[model samples]
Target: MIVIRTPGRLSVRLQPRVLAVGTVCLLLTLAVGVLAVGHGEYPMSPTDVLRTLTGGGSPAEEFIVTQLRLPRLATGLAVGTALGLAGAVFQSLVRNPLGSPDVLGFTQGSATGALVVVAVGGGSAVLAGAAALGGIVTGLLIYLIAWRRGVHGYRLVLVGIGVSAILTGVNGYLMTRVPLMSASRAMLWLTGSLDGRGWSDAVPLLAALAVLMPALLACAPALRMTELGDDAASGLGVRVQRTRMLLLAGAVLLVALSAAAAGPVPFVALTAPHLARRLTRSPGVTLLPAAVIGALITVLADQVALRALPGQLPVGVVTGVIGGGYLVWLLATERRAGRL
Candidate 1:
């Protein structure tokens, strides 16, 4: 740990392995991003893509790269980064591998909110607003319901799982009650497509991340200290409950904004942080590395979904398949280690 202290303010510590892993992941994300931009139906060469981005290409090339592809690419990166950071915070808080927005009912709650708006003929903005509202409400509900004297990690996970099941059922019922066209729209949204996304979709997510990520990072030292146990953390002068609440709030906001932008893309949050941890060999979560990995996975998954199938499938479908397999493997590994 490399601690840098200013005279009056709090100190920031950097780990060398985390920095190295983050750099590698960032490079990989850039490579995947370039590939994603260059491999579409109207494929452009890497040189052409770069030229277009740098304002040196012709009208059609510029249109394809800037107007058509860049927005989707930007949305994917922002959504992935938000999800990964949120997931890292939640998993660290709960001290469980399975603790994520998707598994903990927050995603389902957001989906339910959006589906309700869509079913009632709301437009994109309204739907996004509703989704964020629903996620925040659900997160609060889970936190309150799981609290006895205070929240326990296992209890919180269990409550979230139960709440998630209920929300899933509610979403399904709402789908059945809506008009066929509306239902189709809802289904497509639920599957989490990046199709036809523009700056309208991408910008809000980017803005949200810009605000929330720094707050999450600011809470990082408290988060790490809290992992040493609440009593120890308190003894070390960290305000344990306040720190947890602040971290939880940051995590929820990130999840809400990401879900609003991309309709709850599955498992990126759940999988990316763990992968980052492994890569860095870090005892605690590596937020920057996790964010980079998430962006790479999302961009790569979107690329595969677009090209690997007869029709363009939703990005969530590809991630769901991959994440399902990862989930099974995780379960097996945990069982072998007597952690399950």
Candidate 2:
């Protein structure tokens, strides 16, 4: 740990490996973004993509890059980053890898909300809002149900699993009650499509991040402290419950926002932080690194969905397949270590 201190005696510790991992992940994300932006039905070279982005390409290239693909990429980046950040904070706060919003049923809540909108004849424009509301409500419910004096990691995890299973059933029931067409729409959204997404979809997610990320940074120091058990954190002058609540609140909002934008693309939330941790070899949370990996995985998965298959597939499909495999591997590894 390298500590930098100011004249006022405030110090920040920097981990070199974490910094290096973040940088590498960021570069990879950008490279994949370029690739995703350049290749489509009307493929452009990387140079054309760069030139178009920088205001130097022809009108057609600009149309394809700017109007066609950029917004989708932007939305993907925002959703991935949101999930990654949320996952890191949630896992860190709960001290459990299975504590992600997806596993905890927050994403199912979001899906239920969007399904409600579909059932009510609402359009895609309102689906994100409904999803966000549902996720928030579900988060509050989880907190209340899990709170006993204060929330414990293990108890919260157990309660969240139960809530998730219930929400899964609810989502299935809601799907059956809707009309066939509406149910189809709901199914696509539940599968987490980025199809036809535009600037409007990207803006709200970016704005939410703008407001919420600083709060995450502010909570970081305390978040690390909270990792050292409640007793130790409290001994170190940390307000354990307060810190936990703040972290949970921030994470929930992030999960809600991402689900709103991208229809709860699975496994990004659950896998990105763990991948970041392995790359960084860091003990605590690698929030920034996780965010980068999240963006990378999302954009890369979307690319695979678009180009590697017979037809374009929903981004969620690719993520779900990849994330499912990663989860199996993780569970096996943990089981062998007697930690499962």
Candidate 3:
């Protein structure tokens, strides 16, 4: 008797479950965003929000929903997804759950770039492009410097931290040198405000994500192999350096897109992958799931921030409160385990 083993494509076989979860998360995000649209001082109902979105509401309501809230909601979702996907990619490539754009300074680089553009009186679109370029440049520089034969996760983290500190100083100096009014506006952007965001702001973010996410997803198989130790991966015919470079580039692109959209909303990129890994109980971070979780967290957080207080709070503030607390807890736990 002869025995045969069947080979299967794990990723494709899991596609249905992945698709189901993604669809559910997307619907939930839409529902939350819709409800949030109706929630400010003017207060439209969900039906009103839908009617406004679909061109059936009163002009005033339409303006509020379509012009004001819609963009904010869309930006929140787009930024969240970008950060989440970036976080997942970084965490997987580095084989460390803590490897995220925010943690590693890519966000700071993007922020610095955007700040320079804003300080120089550039338009918002230009500012976004500048931010993306900054993030990519900084990420590539760090990767190149950290590449000792190949990339090491620890070296990357160290270089990133240094880069972050340097950029932060530059950002502060730029803010201080600018005229008061311009500085004030730049500060708002720095703090990640959704105020006055219209369809215009939403357009670029959505477009970037549309173009970038597919490319990142296509890199997933290589990402998985690279997560196996470099030696093991190389033995299995993976071109470790080339694959890692590609992965790093994809991660940087996603991160830059996110930072440009939302002014480097802190901690989302740092925390979302860990949260996704924990939630799915997966051995490693998966990009698609992480993006979904990131979108949900931000969309819901924005909803809470909008209505939780007597006045509107910046969505970043909401994420900061939760993410900061989690970071503290994580540190404490690591210390207790003698791992910090």
Candidate 4:
């Protein structure tokens, strides 16, 4: 007699391929991060940095890497992961490749909220919370206004673009009202900087990751069902509208938290998912893989901004340049395929 048995397990199961890709990315990022530690203005050898990392270096070397570089690296990792995952979720939820908080005005709304708090001289924590609320509110408003016969992806995107433009104007106008020194600082924040970031900045970002990452992971099964269209998803007993709302809220929270921590580092949310899809050849945007790629991009870009440039360049500048090129290439490729 032959018996078929089901294995009982409470362990997390990851695809062997996905695990392999993730491992490669993690290793690459670590190697690049180590290289980055050696390329700053006051250069330290990789050996010295490694020793400092392992807690056996001189005081100055320890101060440079552990105190300065480590915090910046940590911030990059957290913020990039947040943006990338947020982008993947938004894109999958809306079923549009271009759907990202940065493009859809969510980050713009967050920026406006943070700017308001800054203008009013509020604390960073307050700014972060307000920014999150503002992002959610803006996304909801866009969804509501774009809801005609039903929510069309193109219509939602257009409405979001309009909202983003208005928010950009408001951000610019608000900056004009602040004093010059404060305005300069605000401008740097808008452009996104990891300079002078410390353990303090990591706290809120870590908190957001702790809260939202699991929520997103939990919703993955529902989101997977959602890809089958609302009627089909409803047939499968998924609460379609509720699932969308939850996903949107999670995405907004992730983007807002990252923006609050790093001040709107652009395009990670827009480009990372697409890059992941291409890399994995996955039928859809894979959130975890995208987040890993985004973290790598941000950390490496920050390193370039810090070391390769003649002077300090904000991380956003590097991202914008690379992301813009990617966008152009995507458009060109789509046009060639008659899909644009």
lDDT of 4: 0.80
Instruction: Give per-residue CA lDDT, model 3, range 70-189, as digits (tens).
Output: 888888888889888888888887777678787788878887888788777888889878888889889988888888978877788888888888988888898888889888777776
Task: State how far residue 246 of model 1 sits from its true place (Å).
Answer: 1.2
The TM-scores of all predictions, comma-separated, are 0.90, 0.93, 0.85, 0.85
What lDDT score is found at residue 55 in candidate 4? Answer: 93
Ranking by TM-score: 2, 1, 4, 3
Q: Taking the tens digit of each residue's C-alpha lDDT, what string does model 2 give over 1-340?
A: 7889999989888999998889988998899999989987898888889888999999888888888899999999999999989999988988987779977889988988998899887777798899999999999999999999998888888888999999999888888999998888888888887888899898998998998888897888888888899999999999999889988988899889888888989889888988887777787888888888888889989998998986899999998677567656765665335332
lDDT of 4 by residue, 1-340 (tens): 2234457644455566666777788788888888877766778777888888899988888888877878888888888889888988988887888788878998889888877877877776686677777776788888898888666567878999999999999998888888787777677877877877787777778788888888887888788888888889889998887777777777887887788778889888888887776656556658788888788878878887877887889998897667557756765665335332
- Order by lDDT, highest first: 2, 1, 4, 3
Each candidate's lDDT (Cα)?
0.85, 0.87, 0.77, 0.80
Question: Model 1 segments beyond 4 Å from truth?
Answer: 1-13, 323-340
| lDDT for position 315 in model 3 | 77
Shift of residue 141 alpha carbon in model 4, Å: 4.0
- Model 2 Cα displacement at 301 (Å)? 0.4
Q: Find the 10 residues in a row with the least total lDDT in model 3.
A: 9-18
Q: Candidate 1: what lDDT? A: 0.85
**Residue 245, model 3, lDDT:** 83
